[model samples]
Target: MPKKTRRSVDGSRLMQEDEAMTTGGAPGSPGGLEEIFGSLDSLREEIEQMRRPTGTQDSPARTCQDLKLCHPELPDGQCQPQGTQKY
Candidate 1:
């Protein structure tokens, strides 16, 4: 059998399509870097919010109270062992 030939590809057109997909618009247009950076900033802010601790108190005494509720057999002021606690 004769060797098959490969079809030519338009490299520039492929690049343009890729850029449009990545930037959500034509390359170098207003919807490109600015939009991407804005989205990234919002995402960063969301992540920072998640990292921050909420104002709600989570003291060890509260945890002991909760554990006491879960395991009434345990005496007051006693919490279950770390490995033995129920999930």
Candidate 2:
């Protein structure tokens, strides 16, 4: 009898998914999903972080920089902040 192939989940892939879910950046990193766990507070924090006024401590420009920064899981120029449309 042939054994069934078990699907293996990649840790890096899962981390990237979590980054997207948090809508902020990963912990210890600037300008990512930043959501430790999928909870109401973390989600709200990410939202408020995004809605921050311009020229604040971390301005849109800075966030954009992080967005532009390359990650192992993301392709070049594909890490733009959520809802950003560069048409």
Candidate 3:
């Protein structure tokens, strides 16, 4: 009696089928979804950081001194005690 031979399956065909099923046959570069989600996550982190308080001193003297240095064009009164801005 002669022994029967088994045929091998094509690996490339299997891979293609898997990719099609996973991506739903959408026409786009690979891994595009991951990149977009990564960008959104980073943006969310940045927004959260902005929402948090900076915990810096808000004393009138310190604020006035900083304003004077940054806005030399402003009159000394604006950078002084009564006119000092919190922001």
Candidate 4:
């Protein structure tokens, strides 16, 4: 069970301001979609950077063998090399 609550005018005003900031647009202004797209592009770039591997010891690049060395801790047998059997 839940009780219904009404939003106050002040809360509504704050939400409008937050929306403006999120869209990078003022009330009754154009180019809001462009601004939002630009923000999204920036966010995409940030996410790409975070996905890249850092050149530190903890984030050092390793080969498939190295990955297999740590395979016991891997989920779904990831990094485990497949065997080549002769017929």
Candidate 5:
């Protein structure tokens, strides 16, 4: 006969859930967030380091629409930003 593990619904279970939520992620997965922000902050710093001199600066300061891609609410594949070209 095999033994079946029992699940608790009270204090111990809540503590377990809390502990799980507090960590960055599971032990081995690279999807953990510390890596993500580190990469993105690095990219933003790279962008800021570029030279955009006066009179010759033809770039939009940052189209608000482009900035939206940085938000969690924006959908993926849309950031390639087709149809946004301005004449």
Candidate 6:
């Protein structure tokens, strides 16, 4: 069996790491972690809004009706009642 040589583990540090170490908010700086948390909270709110049901009118049955209206040649079984239609 050939002896396997381990490669050097040390790699060049990224520029972003150096910047992150140097540049930071002063004591008076308004926006930093608080701003990030606020943005995250807003994002969570938006995600919750998206996760919630919009309305019953825009449901799968309505979608099936729209699809059926667009393509009448498609079998009724492909839409609803007799068969399952997924959004």
RMSD of each: 11.8, 19.0, 11.0, 12.6, 12.9, 14.2
lDDT of 2: 0.51
Candidate 1 error regions (>4 Å): 1-7, 15-30, 54-87
lDDT of residue 56 for candidate 1: 28
Per-residue lDDT for 3 in model 2? Answer: 56
For candidate 4, give the lDDT. Answer: 0.53
The per-residue C-alpha lDDT of model 3 at residue 33 equals: 64
- Per-residue lDDT tens digits for candidate 2, residues 13-74, read 77876775576665557554333445767778877666553323464534444534422343
Candidate 3 regions with alpha-carbon error over 4 angstroms: 1-21, 24-26, 54-87
| Residue 8 local lDDT, model 4 | 31
> Which candidate achieves the best TM-score against the true structure?
3
Query: How badly does each model clash, as a count of residue pairs?
Result: 0, 6, 0, 0, 0, 0
lDDT of each: 0.54, 0.51, 0.55, 0.53, 0.47, 0.51
lDDT of 3: 0.55
What TM-score does each of the candidates earn? 0.34, 0.21, 0.35, 0.32, 0.30, 0.30
**Cα-based lDDT at residue 70, candidate 3:** 51
lDDT of 4 by residue, 14-63 (tens): 78877876776766675677877899999987665445433224543244
Instruction: Score candidate 6 by lDDT.
Output: 0.51
Residue by residue across 1-87, what tens digits does model 3's lDDT show? 556455656679778767855774423466666777789999987665444423234322334445555545655443233555544
Q: How would you encode candidate 5's per-residue C-alpha lDDT over 1-87 as one tens digit per residue?
A: 555456534677667655654675433553456777789998887575343311113443254444443343534332233434221
Write one digit per residue (lDDT tens) for candidate 1, span 11-86.
8988887877676665557467667778999999766544442212432323444545545675443234442332
Q: 17 in model 2: Cα distance from truth in Å?
A: 31
For residue 12, what is the lDDT in candidate 2?
95
